[model samples]
Target: MWTTGAEQVEQAVAECVELLGAVTGRDWEGVRAGRLEWSCRRTAVHIAEDLIAYAGQLAGREQESYAPFELVLEEGAGNADALRVIGTTGALLAAAVRTTPREVRAFHPYPFRSANREGFAAMGVAEVLLHTHDVAEGLGLAYEPAPGLCDFVLTRIFPHVRPGESPWRTLLWATGRGELPGRPPVAGWRWSNNLVLGTERLTLQGVTPAAAADLAAVGDGGFAWIEGGPVEGTRVGAGLVHQQYEDGVHLPEWGMYVLVRREDGRAIGAMGFHGVPDAQGRVEVGYDLVEGARGRGHATEALVALSRWALDRPQVRTVVANVERGNTPSQNVLARAGFARVAEDPGHLAYELREPGEG
Candidate 1:
């Protein structure tokens, strides 16, 4: 339920309202929220505003920009009224999250320009948890949300933050709301949503760590695959992805992707980076298809899409691929995808595709 969205948003909102509603008669306007310039009253209204905005984006299927509307409270409204608005908007967000399909992506401009249901829910939960802390601190009301909610947000969106001794404290530290023992002060931060790109017949679905762990265990990674699907290499790649995730070094975009046929929704293959772009901006890539689906140009299509996506990144100057010396079919796939045989050895062959301007 937490992973899906609606239940988690409801859970977070329940905690937020219960905590703040208890102190409704306090001087919310006079007391500044902890570590923020806004008064506690303003912070409460911001929560409602963000919740409704997210709901609008999903419910309206907003693309390219936010749904052009703002939440304005009536003049002379008090703290109880603001808390009521939070509950109402929170319900709207929950309904939106429940109704939005997993495949549907809406506009969000952070590291990427789009976000799916899970991303919006995680963002919503983060806002409620973090800002409520600020409000609680200022009003001298005790508050600590469920650690599981914090864990959910961190894993789904805050993939770059390493897990610390305490999940809640770690989340606070990651967001610049608190301190850690040794890590540098977080001067800036942004949440990342997984990227999806489409080809003629395939959607290169970015693999989340949750999916990776299941795939590594020979599961479908929540994707429906063609018969004789997800061969050993794919599982091995998934294991590698899960390892990176467990180590907290996995960037979702740089991780694995499952190639799913759009028409029938059957997964055809897997393709992705071996790791993030190296210091020189060189990134290694690998791909494999199910036996029954091979030789249909699926590998070539996915390779081209993944390579194009990688090269388009300003940090990536080249994409590297390694094939066993005897693998003629694999070499043909790479060649068809426009990768050149840049180097070779006794047992292995190397290919590299460089950005157009790379010397």
Candidate 2:
């Protein structure tokens, strides 16, 4: 995967500054920004606001809410000044992303309540790209960001969106800002940061389509893994995820999660659903651990946590798993995680964990 971080943030801001700098002397306050109600000047200021806010979120480690502060320019600040502020704030955000530890996550109110450093960086890039387009359109100037920048935003935060002929157009369409061929115009939209669930000793980080593609291609999927990790099973599972994403049927929260140890931050395994729940409210799950990490209760702990999370959902009544008849260790993990055998075929045994108090 093309890693998104401080570097991407800096690149995006540089592009924004260079583009807007050329028109700084124009009457930005009087003209509306493309389809937006804000003027080009206000849109530029908004970009700076987002950049600094993301920086504060990481630097302050503010959890539960945004940091109790806002960005305000001195009265009479001009377009050139706003561009300078954008550059400064973008650098601040980049510094935060660079210094933040991989495990750190702070508050962000989106489809989820939190985002890590990469998430914030991706969001910052997105703000610069989209709003820059708006301002450019209003100014009657042509603009197109680098395809990789657009792809970076799409793969990391817009994982559910199907790749279109152009990553830029696909991003615009996904955000309800533009049209695309053969697809309904987006009515409303929100970008998703991958979900992360915590257990006593593990954090089950949801795998984005970007990570899925990398893992399927034998990359580390951006994770630091224990030896023998990302085993064949994990890669196979990742391939299925990428396939679902390509098919445009992937629901992120119901997808794969890498089980990273909370104590040391090393990924030891993967666990997740086959897909969304069926008509009977049943969802199938599977998991695997690196050879060096097995027999330490990691799989059982993750299975128990994941199964409970699934069962608690209103649409889920049972969490199911299948184990080959000869894989007694796998069967034992399921048993310890509260799954009861429900059926058996010649090759495998099926187990189910029902919601609490369900007969």
Candidate 3:
């Protein structure tokens, strides 16, 4: 799988600068960016601001809220000066992304409250690409980033949005900048960062489509796995995730999550719902741990945390699981996680953990 990193950030910034550089003589302050209230000049500054702000979040390790700072250009700064600032700030963000550890996540208020390095990198690329387009439209200049750059942003951050005929156009449509054939006009939109849930000893990190594709292809999915991980079952689950994403029905919160040890930050297993809740508010879950990491309560701990999270949602009345009748260890994990066996077949026993007082 292709990964987003400092290089992508640098590439996006380069594309933005190259496109806007040719139009510096134009009246940027007087012209409004495409469909936005801000002028082209203001939009350019916003791109630089977002780049540095994201860098600060990761470098400073600020949690719970944004850092108390902003990027301000000097008075009488020209378009050339703004471009220089953009270049400098883009480099800073790239450096931060390059240095940040894979497991480290910082505050970002999207659908989720935090984002990892890849998430931040994708966001940086997105700001540059989208704002450049706005400025290009305002200046009457043609602009389009590389399709791979757009794909990087989409697979990582826009997992819920369906892939359209063109990734760039789909990105435009998703951001409410343009329209697509089958999809309605987007009146309001926000890019999603994958969900991360914390347990006492584990952090259940939602797997993005990018990561899922990698995992399904026998890759690490950008995770630092313990020995003998992520096992065959995890790979199979990842394949299902990518398939759902391809079909455009995958919901980030309902997708797979890697169970990472809080103590060491190494992935030991995977766990998540088979799909969204049914009409009766029931959802099926499955999980497996790496051979080297099993039998030490990691699976049970993750299951309890994940099941509780699912049960807490108003739409979920019951969390279900099916284990082969011969798999005593797997059965015990579900039981310890509060799942009561609800049914049996010739090949499997079904378990369900219900919301409190639910029959």
Candidate 4:
């Protein structure tokens, strides 16, 4: 996914340059970029600005606010010069994406405060594709990016939007550039990054669809793990998340999360919900740790943070977990996390945590 993303930066820039080069003699400053209030020239510069900024984030591993510099063009620059800048910045972003480790997330102030390499790539591609369309619309030129590019961005970033038959059209609609038949007009929007939760010593990183795919295929899901870590259960959980993405019903915030130790960035375990919250505001939870990392209360710590996060949401009133009958350690972890034994089946015991005021 990372390789494809970087390759796409090159392709998208090439297409945009070719399309806009055909009309360099025209007055870009006088024409508005599609529905945006900014002129076509300004929009073109915005594209270059975003590309370079994303590159800086990845290259610098910016964790908090944005990097403290902007990409301002030289004096006497024209549409042609802007296009050249776009090409250069696009290449820079591609290089950054290629070199940045998959687990490295940087500042991207969308709904979430950070984004991984794939997320940055998808956002970069979207910027190139959409702005090119806007410039083309203003210049009276035709523009349509590849369907696969649109699909890549949609699946990676716009997880909440229902897909349409046409990926380009759907992507255009997602960014408020066009329309889909069944959906309402989007007047306000924010691209969602994967949610990250911090505990006293760990950060629970949400697994994206791309990461989930890699994890399901016996990959590390881009995490550095503890000894004998990312056990079988993590792989199985990743498979389920990947399947949910394929089915287009995966709520990104409800998917699996890897618990990474803050001191060393080594992943200790995985934990998450079975699915989205039910109508009755109930959801199932599960967790597992590496054999060497067991009995250290990592699971208990993660469960408490995750359970609190879940119950704090309006749609979740209870979180439940099912443990094998003989797994005393697991049961103890749940008890430590404030989950009461709720019920028992033939082979397992059910534990639950209700919102304090509810019961």
Model 3 spans > 4 angstroms off = 1-4
Top candidate when judged by TM-score against the true structure: 3
Q: Residue 337's C-alpha lDDT in candidate 3?
A: 91
RMSD of 3: 0.9
For model 4 the local lDDT of residue 114 reads: 92
lDDT by residue (55-125, candidate 2, tens digit) is 99999998899998889989999999999999999999999999998889999998789998889999999
**Per-residue accuracy of model 4 over 84-158 as CA lDDT, tens digit each:** 999999999999989987568899998888998878988999899999999899888889988878877877787
Off by over 4 Å in 2: none
- List CA RMSD, all candidates: 2.4, 1.1, 0.9, 2.7
Q: What are the lDDT figures for the candidates, one per model?
A: 0.88, 0.93, 0.93, 0.88
Q: What clash pairs does model 2 have?
A: none
Order of quality (TM-score): 3, 2, 1, 4
Q: Which model, 3 or 4, shows the larger TM-score?
A: 3
Against the correct fold, how does model 3 do in TM-score? 0.98
How do all models score by TM-score? 0.90, 0.98, 0.98, 0.88
Query: Candidate 4: deviation at residue 188, Å?
Result: 2.4
Error of 4 at 291 (Å): 3.5
Ten-residue region with minimum lDDT total, candidate 3: 1-10
Query: Candidate 1, which ten residues in sequence have the lowest lDDT sum?
Result: 1-10
